[model samples]
Target: MPENLTAEQWRSFVASRRTTRDFLPTPVPQELIDQLLTDAMTAPSWSNTRPYLVAVASGQARDRISTELLNRWDSAAKALAGGLWGKIKIFITRYGLPQSDYKVNRKYPAELKPRSARVGAELYGLLGIARDDHEARRAQWGRNYEFFGAPVSLFIFTHRGLGEYSVSDAGLMMQNLMLSAHAHGLGTCAQGATALWAKPIRDEFNIPKDYNLLCGIALGYPSDDKVNTFKADRLPIEKIKLLPKNA
Candidate 1:
């Protein structure tokens, strides 16, 4: 709770967060993101190994990724859809259910979500995009390639050699970044889309060779009320929680 702020203001600030897909074009100073990354590192880690690294892509670097990734996605879309120009085709059909499914299967590890459409929905919702507006939605997702036009990007990585426990540590670090981003009134989206393109992106950004890309964080100022409106899906508390022995 904030003693400097009323309880309402404190709660409102902490409660605000969204994986923003659209962003204003204005530049965020490097100092702010630097402070954010420093705060993010404060997140708890196993034995304090602190293996997290951030690779930022801004300006030209940001533009390159945006162009390439969108091009790749557009190519896949065309090939799967047989270059359809109009009408709302079912996602699976438009993308060739079998082939798209195979791509998902081959690309993602067991833990990552493989559905590109599902990821798109979460992103568009954060930006208040309407359903069936495929162009708008795709354009919004393209913003990720543009680093949400934030001028800074934070890539989360972990050592390939770490055990699940260390992976969990890295995850905690990601959460810290998300929470702190909310507190700072900055919008962010945790982009797993890059997971499939990790190697390409890693090389593209000149990331150190030892790091494996866990995910990408698209950071920036929201174009609208992204923080408040981007509600999350959650299960009931009872569905996910149970006391071990004190029932």
Candidate 2:
């Protein structure tokens, strides 16, 4: 006989989870969303203050927000794509060739420094998005605005002047929500992309100006037919470790 399926089985099960962008626009029950929020609040926080807060939107509000985001993205992308051959190279390379009135880099915790593309690649593979599909990939990125078609959207944030520990706490809580969503048969995308929309979103959602927009996560039952399915690999433990000097 055989023992129960071991590490491989568990890995395969979790690995099947992926970031789904091709949403069916079906309505998710309010109770289910409620449960997710409940689980999200359980996330660890510094001094147990749980400074983070969430805003959920559905129906017309969701649609309007996505529309505005797409319009802004199109205008910004076109501007970046415009210019003479010489100028275009500047956009392609390093420098001051293509500048935009709207281009923005979302704030990140420099102290909590992390490499985004590495994690993004894992999700891209699971989403079945090709490495070279810049346009397709970017369009997929825009899905964050639509809550990835899940019919509900979540906004996450914290006070602007939080200390380092608080930001870390928020990140931990976010991770808890994402993992809980996964364990509950929901697909989620940890959306740093939406950081660029912070100002617009803060105004749109009526959040106090001093709260820092941390990130967003789009959650829903994944579409079986869509290309997205499976999880990306995490960095090996060895890669993340440094030998202790005392040892």
Say which candidate scores most in lDDT.
Answer: 2
Clashes of 2: 2
Colliding residue pairs in candidate 2? 15-231, 16-230
* lDDT tens readout by residue for model 2, 89-167: 5456534321221233645567433655666776677677899987777777666666667776676777656656656
The alpha-carbon lDDT assigned to residue 185 of candidate 2 equals 73
**TM-score of each candidate structure, all chains considered together:** 0.71, 0.73
Worst 10 residues of 2 by lDDT: 94-103
Question: Which residue pairs collide in model 1, if any?
Answer: none
